[model samples]
Target: MLRRFGSKFLQNSLLLTLSGLYSTAALHAQQPAVNPAPIPLNPSQKAAAIAGNVQGKALIQQATALLKSGQLDSAIPILQRASVLRYVDPTSHFYLGLVYDQKGMSQMALENYTLAIKRANALGMDSAQLRINLGNTLCKLNFLKEAEFDYKRAIEIDDKNDVAHLNLGRVLLFKGDNQGAFRELSRASALMATDPNLPLYQALALKGMGNNEECKNQLQIFLDRAAGTHSDPRVISMAQNLLAELK
Candidate 1:
């Protein structure tokens, strides 16, 4: 994953208790008790919830496979069906967010991600992945302060989460906190050295600090990594041109 301004959705799925885009089996298995007990579900309501979970799980599985195949049109309805189930976990809402995000439905994505976070928190599962994803969506919607809070919260839960560090660096950079950006990105680099785009952000942080030599070195590192590993060609080309200018 790119360190700055990149979606952590895919990475977050793998890293968290939520395993994939649409698997809520783990959450369903737990059935965590709600903290402030509201009117408890009646027997009929309980039966419906159980039935909803079974149907929802099957729908989610199908939706996940469809999403992986780039079948967003097909996945959306399945995900929508899954989202209404009482037993559906944050993962379902999260994938719904992703599907909406992919379909250019920013408002819908934000709504579902928000719901996912709320549901996750209510379940007493402070998943770092959920926070990072919510942060990413918040950033996309220009909710920078909210994004920063989520990223910071993610770090608090899992201090070593590189995705949180990477995202926090970008948020700090945008806020003109270059030193803070450098610190977070450096920590991310320590955790994820093989990522090709990190040095580019580091270079930008150095440039903001007026440390031109270090900036150039970071740009060179980006170029080397880009050449040897996977990276967006547009980003790599930009780095190459910037490196020459720095030289």
Candidate 2:
């Protein structure tokens, strides 16, 4: 169920730091709980399915298949085609951005996200998600100041966006501002326990403040809880290595 709910930003900085988190795959897994009964699609809409586009119901499902199968290389061409179609929706471009990000094609990803952003703004669409994605990408690219501005803009648009807070906190932590990072991470943790990054980041923030014992305990708790969560190998490995060295 990789929906790419808000990963337009990761595409831009995927080469620098490939972290997508629950914003796409993990966030989509939560959808069933939110919408227990999906409305049936109309037959006329079924006829609108791309006829010559490889026989798929729509470009989106085809792209999803490519992504799920890890055939990212094969997906890009199809995604590009979809984006150029007259009837193509913003979601098409959004997922294209996600694919490029996952494939480590930052420039292409950024371009797609920018396109999506423009279209969303034009239609007064769900622009907040695009802002979050762009902010996350900028943060990874080491453009922390600009990324922070995007996150603040997102907050202004949607005060309850927990992912934006988490991302902003991560940037603050990387900037060596432990106190500010802690506040944002704490708020994100309060909003979603599924976010392993919160506790793991909290430990790092504590470590930065020279609270060695507290950091160790928090890291141990995070490691234990994160074991079955499919946490990224890189993130888990880095955190574990850091904790061991700290002790």
Candidate 3:
């Protein structure tokens, strides 16, 4: 049964929540709530806002297409123009952060992600995915505490966010909070039962808590599930080494 489940998981692994990138559905999920008492705008002001919004949408669409085609450099200017628009969508800054992150520019990614959050707030929008992306950049910059905070906030926004829970588990592990890491990992595992990586993380947390037997069991489960899949070779190697050490 486990093998069958593992094979099914491997086949659908592309849909895993680990990646911090937002899909079109996720973008829509982050849409701002309707304001019951929106501030009235004058006719000219509303007309100008509509024009800016239309232009910004076009730029964002163009940038998204470039990003999809792996033309990260070309996407940058278009997204930058969108970011400066009068009614800019926060998604522009979010995409800019993703491009910078993919380019290995952690500081630039962090800056854009910060701007994204600020813009999102201004637009009366809150997004778990945005927080997750920002947390990922923070992790890359070695800002573990900041990343933890972001992950926690993401969870608060959407408690069912398995990515946030998984990331929070990782951060807790790094901070040597073994029990806390285990608790978060358990929650993530419950939320995403098919994720093979969860067992590895759970094993690490168990090992940290000196539960050698349980850790070994989790390592074996990880190895079994990861076999014949596209799991990271480095991670598999580490799991093998850890399992051997436990033995």
Q: Of models 1 and 3, which has the larger lDDT?
A: 3
Off-target runs (Cα >4 Å) in candidate 3 are 1-45, 86-88, 193-195
- Candidate 1: list runs displaced more than 4 Å: 1-39, 228-234
Q: Residues 61-106, candidate 2, lDDT per residue (tens digit)?
A: 6776777777877877777776665233465567667776666566
Q: Give the per-residue Cα lDDT of candidate 1 at 221.
A: 77
Give the 10-residue window scoring lowest on summed lDDT in candidate 3: 20-29
Best by lDDT: 3
Rank by lDDT (best first): 3, 1, 2
lDDT of 1 by residue, 5-48 (tens): 12222222212211112111121122222332244789998788
The alpha-carbon root-mean-square deviation between model 3 and the true structure, to one decimal in Å, is 8.0
Rank the candidate models, highest TM-score first.
Answer: 3, 1, 2
Which window of 10 residues has the lowest lDDT sum in candidate 2? 27-36
